[model samples]
Target chain A: MRDLELNMVFDPSEVLRPSSFQDAVETLDSSDSKIVAGNTSLYSLARKGRLENIKKLVDISKLGISYIKEAESQTSEEKKILVGAGTTFQEITSSSLINGRPEYAGLKEALNKSPPQIRNVATIGGSICSAVSFYDLPIVLFALGTTLKFFSKKEGEHLITIDSFFQNPALYGKSLLIECQFSSSPNSASSFVKLCRRMSGYAVAMTAARIKLDRTSREIDDIRLVIGAMTKTPQRLNQVEEELRHKEPSIETITRMCEKSADLVHDIIPSVHASTAYKKRVLPILLREAITTAVERATER
Target chain B: MLNETRIKVRFILNGESRNIECMAADTLFDTLRDSLGTMSVKQGCDFGGCGVCSVLLDGRPVYSCLMPTWKVEGSKIETLEGLKGKELMNLDAIQQAFATNFAQQCGYCTPAMILNAKALLERNPNPSVDQIKDALSGVLCRCTGYMPIVEAVMQAAMMRRKKTQV
Candidate 1:
């Protein structure tokens, strides 16, 4: 390790600060460059000698992408929150557009999972591009059914769902994520629960659930459950969601379904901190807590 | 190919404007300690996990180890050194509170703790205990057990509020 550290140095040839969006795309398409925003994860990778491939570092923080605003959706009933790619977690958490609404409680919880220092600098675009499973934002955003906008060299501009983006993030390596939009509904509420060894540490098992309840029936109208830190990418509990979809979620029924969640999870990634068995045991508890909280919040709405 | 290109970045440090040349990949922690001779910015895990290198960038607390130096161009950067008043003997209210409350033991994490506290106090002068803990969550201190640090920040907040009223 010492020898590797001595040999691997993060000495990029040049750092380009593109003044315009078009200029940034041209630079990224023409050269062996990487987009740097926040530089939180990039610096960590550099310290571990994992960023040896890049030649040029393109600083994209100056491209003027930091913002948060509510936009009109195709359907007048659903409102979409548009967040700039360069917007930091702190900005997202403190934004009145997100904070004032109870439907986005899950996102607020997930963003607050990180320490203030990281929240102050780490951008949403950087987190999504990194595609690390331990990150809380991707999992919560996935449950919220977020859509990402990107500008690529080959494809001028396009929008991809959060689910598809996580499946193969490497496909869009050269592309710049411009912004992300997630819809907020009146009847829906989301919640995120993570169990870790220490405060602000990497998750042992984390779960995010978003549920919309039928107003009169009080049954589960729609649900999305995503579990992270157990796989290379965040996995959705489709089996459990299918069982709970149309049925009225009770404390007992949710508990029973989540207990069987361990069997439904496949490709459990091994961790240095927690054993596979322990994660399996803890997965159900996290799922139960997340779903219960989300259901309670949704009912209140 | 190994790139040795250097970049010149200008930013306001404390109250003064300064310019320094460094590698494009160098972190703010590196430029502060190695280049500009700001030794209070302690290097811990070098990863964002440890907040020993915490500093206020544009009045917001951020891990200096994680911030690329060039990103601070035209922004304000504050460290523990900047907390001192015009006279060397005058310490910021937060520092004075920390000294009286026994917030430091090894003193390695004190600079970061103080800076994080300063940022918190600046934003919310009357922060609750939980709020103070949340703000100080970034900086990890092996000594002090954290209670003293929390007390110091609360006391400093009171001192500031009293001073402003007077």
Candidate 2:
């Protein structure tokens, strides 16, 4: 049995302020470092001995990773939503474009469900790096097909898909997520649903859905569904999404697609959660809820 | 072995530049309450679960109890003390609302409540009841039942908006 040390405390010998992404990477390479942005979750984890090897702390709060950039939309050129990794949940929740945009309702819902204290300090970068099941950002970013930009010691600065980035072991000892970028589609609409014991912070199950309907007819065009806390990692239900695209937006279609989610999730991770049996029995209901919410937002006149 | 790591932390406390050499193991709350004599940021729970030690770190509310002192270098740190001498008892709008509405009961949680409300209103001038609830959700108040507290925040928001419009 591994003995847990409750007596351990956070002690950093040096602090680094890196001006650029490359500089941040260089700074991390110097010693055993823990990145501090909002330091909400990271500090909590440190106190709980979750971060067992952290010695030197890197403060990245000053980096411009907290801004949201909006660009003119184009086909070849996608409208960018560059969220500075240091951007807090508070910033995201208070963001005009994010909260106001119909397409981002699911993301906003997730933000709403996150803890208020965490919302104030939990950074997008830290949430991504923490890689916990309950954290809501990863699922939303995954459903949005967001790209995580990181600074690495060997590879320097690079971008990885949120889905693949979570599997990368290099994320732990070295690379740091600096920002997340998603192509903003005006036609896109999203919904996020989580089954928690209570609304404050604890999440036993969560689902995030992003759909883009046909501009003219409002038929479902592209669909993405990501569920978290039900498995070892958040999953993108590609099979169910493929089944729904180009289909008519109806209760029947949503129900069928949702039913397919149970099979899809089982294939991904057999042991889901406490409500594994019940989740499989009732997942269609929640998925349908997410779909209905998305459809209502997408079709709103 | 008790290891003492000394680091220089410079932050804007109540809009004043506070420079102090302290042990890295010390939390920002400890640095303020114990070292700098800013007890407005109370020490409660010694963990982030209790918001009694809440303060504004760069205009965002944070639990100073869990924050390591060295991590806040070059950031703005505002406590209840910062707000006391501004104008008219120097109470900020939220503080004034708390006072008028009797939002505080025991007052142990008032400082953190005010700071949390300050952070919320700074970013959002008019937060919805849900947002207001979420903003104060971290702050645990053993008094006032939170209904009057919420009402005071609402009143403060309305009053602040009227003032701005005028």
Best by lDDT: 1
Q: Model 1 lDDT vs. the true structure? A: 0.87
Error of 1 at A125 (Å): 0.9
Clashes of each: 0, 2
Which candidate's DockQ is highest? 1
Q: Which stretches of candidate 1 lie over 4 Å from their true place?
A: A1-8, A73-76, B86-89
How does each model score on TM-score? 0.96, 0.85
RMSD of each: 2.3, 4.3
Writing each residue's lDDT as its tens digit, candidate 1 over B1-166 gives 4455778889999888998786777778878887778899998987888799999998889998778788888899998888876364787899889889999999999999999999899999999999999999988999789999999999999999999999
Q: Which segments of model 2 are wrong by more than 4 Å?
A: A1-7, A27-31, A71-73, A94-96, A169-172, A267-275, B45-47, B85-102, B121-128, B156-166
